[model samples]
Target: MKYILDFDIAAVCISCITLFLFYERKQRRFGPGESYGRIAWTVLLSSVFSAASSYFANALPGTSGAATMATVTLFYLFHNSIAFFAAVYILNYGGLLPVKKTMRVLLALPWAIAIAAVASNPITRLISYVDSANVYRRGPLFFILYLLSTLYFLIIIAALFFKRSHYRKSHQRAFLAAALAPVLAALIQGFNRGLMLECFGASVSALLALITIQNASELMDGQSGLYHRESFIEFLAGAFKKKEPFTVLIAHSPELADLQGSLEMQNYRALVAQVSKWMFQASGAGAAPSWVGTGVFGLLFSRRLKSNPVGDLALKILDLADASWSVGSLHVKVPFKVTILQCPEDAADISDVVDCIDQIAEVARHSAHKKIYTKFDFSVGKHKRSSAVAAALERCLERESPELFYQPVYSIARSKPFALEVLLGLSLVNNEQAFQSEVLSTAEKMGVSRQLTELTLKKAFEWHAANKQELAGIDQLQLRLVSSMCLDLDWPRTVLKTAADARMDLSKVCFEITETTVSRFGNDLAMNMELLTGKGVSFALDDFGSGYTNLVKLAPMPFSIIKFDKKIIQPGLQSNKGRQLLEGMVDIFKRRECAVAAEGVETEAQAGMLALMNFDHLQGYLFGKPMSGQRIVEALKNG
Candidate 1:
């Protein structure tokens, strides 16, 4: 190789390697994103021409043949075109530029400028020249091209600096470094014309940017080597767009958080690695296993596989995870909940799929038996229905629209009521009530649970304040809050603020928490409950004796009431022995100074039995079905 080919050969080799690394980085089965794939091709082609353009300089004045001149002209044209293309890609990668383009031709202006110069360069020789020694020399107009090229570098830095707040510190540093690398090289080579530096510098800088940042695989968890939530969602979106028949199985270990707290970080990482290895091995090339959350791994597989039903696939994953592994002499068995959903079957849209998975995962996580669940299916029409529901709900909130309803909890001693349980639910477009909506759930998953809770509370408080006078005894109002809403750190404060705004006594308000919430209790729940209980706001253990109601864990809870779930109540109302069990549970709660209520009392016989059992309250259609706030008030007046 000639001494002149040193930088050119180095640039070509580095560019080729960078391109290979870019392609090799994606371990996802879903493939790269459109923008990501486009940018990769631009970078590869740009780097290739950066090296190729160097050779045209060797064809000099002695080689006056039109063929040589044409080759040199074409090389510079391509070289300059790629230069501008690379700058645009960098801007795109840095997220400093907008993704949408109404007119793609509008973006071609920079390339057009470069091409016009290259087209005119042969007649003018402004961009290049053949020296007397048959060597290449820079023309006067070459400085203008150089200026435009360097301007791209400056634009990248300026754009990134403007949007510095949008990026993480590491990303900001990497991108700035990537931009500066070529500029500094251009400056050095400009001072010493014999030293070729710009192409070589840009190639190395790209490699640095690839390794340090500007990588999609950076979406993977650093330790686990699996897709993080953001990347997994991106992968999911691609799958949805493809409309390919595929099954997504999510395994979430609620215990992972606890384990992370208990073990050393290094030991925890090692354990995660072991679990990931199991996931990969179990997947066996057919499925792309990704760590979606703390201990949640999602396996995505196309339908064209040798497989049984989704239930069997879930079972195999469960059995696969059941294997015991040790982390620093500590033997651990990871028990996880499996929730599976199939595309175009369960859901076709990305949002519906996410909502379905999240809802099913939540149910399975707290379930008494973590059986393979496949019940989360939506018809083709349901996607539009769900979107309409979300939009209707959003409109409802914006208008301060209230969907307030109340179920009467009656005193068993008389036919009169003990309290009215306020039930505010999201009304769908079809006027069907979905108390906990997928939109709300998605908000919770996205950490906007606080805002969702605030919106619900705001409307509820508004309705209550407006009807306070008509509602007579407002103190008898009890609210049933979703567990996910309570998990928001701001929920406690929101409750206090709403209560103050409504001019309601906190002591008179009661919050009912279901067994589902209590069983899967976290620190957020514990803290929020304390905030309420501290203000003399009463709590009722709603759906008591439901699945996973661990009485031992419930010991320290500040519950003033216990309402028996229909699962417990119906069976108790069935047999004499079952009735005895019910009485025994009532006695246990009474001993703890909690008022006990029997729910689902649909019969006069059941009502008599509940009354005889000394249950403090009875709630069922036999007393009064849930109705609008106005009807509830009218009913109270009539009674």
Candidate 2:
């Protein structure tokens, strides 16, 4: 009865190592990880018991009878449970089981029966027992338990096969090997009884499962420790396919860019991780938290154990966000814009849900205040319009057919055109109502703002080259830079190269930056402006008085022109106080030797008022509306 313990010893060592690796990963366990964790624990314990059982059973007549029986009973208890736990893991991993207590209890029935039989084996001597000689022997009911265990393995294999389409190829292979390796070895040992391969099979299965299924880096953000965007989207898609009721809450941080710019890279990552942990804890059971995009986090509560209290969770999150967060010697406030959407009610399919999330995230990025949005508050029309524009933008950029319009900036001093502003002639609807801001913002989201800028510059410079003889009176060609391009460090050199390629005079180019973009600019923007300004290009602070205008802050940036926002000029024409303010602003700019332009001037009185205020330039409907390059050139020729 002396059995070779080579396989049992090897299994014990391998399972111990596998279990150590599983726990050492320290991943935030999603549903599949939790189930696989159970399997890891079960397989490791089963291997230990299997090795001990072999030692006692091999000693035969020399081993203590009671001691042998106890070890043998524990071995059967743990060894027979591996298949049952594996089956449960498979069900959970495949999303076959709902997150319900009742369903879980039903799923545990077979394992419960196996545990009961094994626990009572000493008295009944049904499944396994130790003889008087202290040798382990199978009882009459041994095959019954073995058959039940084999049934569980069969179910795992079948589930893996039938659900193959639902999983990636790698997942299918890993799950199949996990189910088949153990059962095949067990079946061989069940017939021969000499080869102790059962535990070895379990160890192999555990190792395979842990390596493939428990690798979190594939599905999670390395910094935030939350599921990545694709993983989160796939989870939602699966839940939707199952018709599982669910709600998603998106938390977008408007200050994320500011935080990134302020903090060191490591410190910034720590801040993101802290925020991610807080969001994850607030989500209820069966909830999955994901880092959907930069500055955007999504919490999906699917098949939740209880009702989805997403609204309260969002409110609580915002309340917490109101306070300052302490991260690595920095006390910073991370503002959030929260929105909740329910499946089948708010979104019809995965595409709809993705589109809605994208558009909402975009809105949240620019929103100034913290607020909450319910399903009813989400604008379906806005989402549809933005989505359409985004799609059209992609096509328009690829085809290089986006329209460009030119508007003249009138010189009040000389009573003629001083500059021609290049504008993107983009519209959201067929009516051709201007949506250049929306188009530019969408281009930023799509990572094509730089492309749009390049295309506009190429077309404008080429048109100017083609119509060099048309009036020959334009002093400057003004091109507005979007926020994304302004933040890019390479923009200065790249734009100069673009201009050089077009053979355009650098002295005649004026780059317009909006007032809001000024606050977000860092040293890189200043350096970029210096580089371009060194090349004889002028810079204009566009849309002044529209936002928090700090003249002292603008003093160091080397802006040569300040354009008054329409909101500023309209009021200046109506009231004495407004006129005084306008005149004072104009006088300050003039003293600094910076030319001032009044934008949005439309009437004779408004034009006269701006002229009296000592505005050097005027641009509005009163001067000229945005028209085609050809028409604009023809008008300049006729005038």
Most accurate candidate by TM-score: 1
Q: For model 2, how many clashes?
A: 0
Tens-digit lDDT string for candidate 2 (1-639):
556678988988998788677666554356445666677777777777777777877777786777777877788788878888888767767776556779778767777788888899999999877876556788888777777787777777777777776567888889888888987887788687778898898889888877787777798889788888988876776667566677777877768756878789988998898888888777743477888887788777764646657777888878866777788888888877788777778876666666656676556545555387655545555656667788778878888987888899999878899899888866545554445677888898889998898888888887887787783798899988888777667878777788788887888889999877888885567778888899899999999998997777687787899999998789778989988988998999998899999889899888888888888899999989999888998898889
lDDT of 1 by residue, 531-557 (tens): 788997988888777677888878888
Worst 10 residues of 2 by lDDT: 24-33
True-vs-predicted CA distance for residue 591, candidate 1, Å: 13
Give me the displacement of residue 166 in model 2, in angstroms: 9.4
Output the number of the lDDT-best candidate. Answer: 2
TM-score of 1: 0.58
lDDT of 1 at 31: 37
TM-score of each: 0.58, 0.52
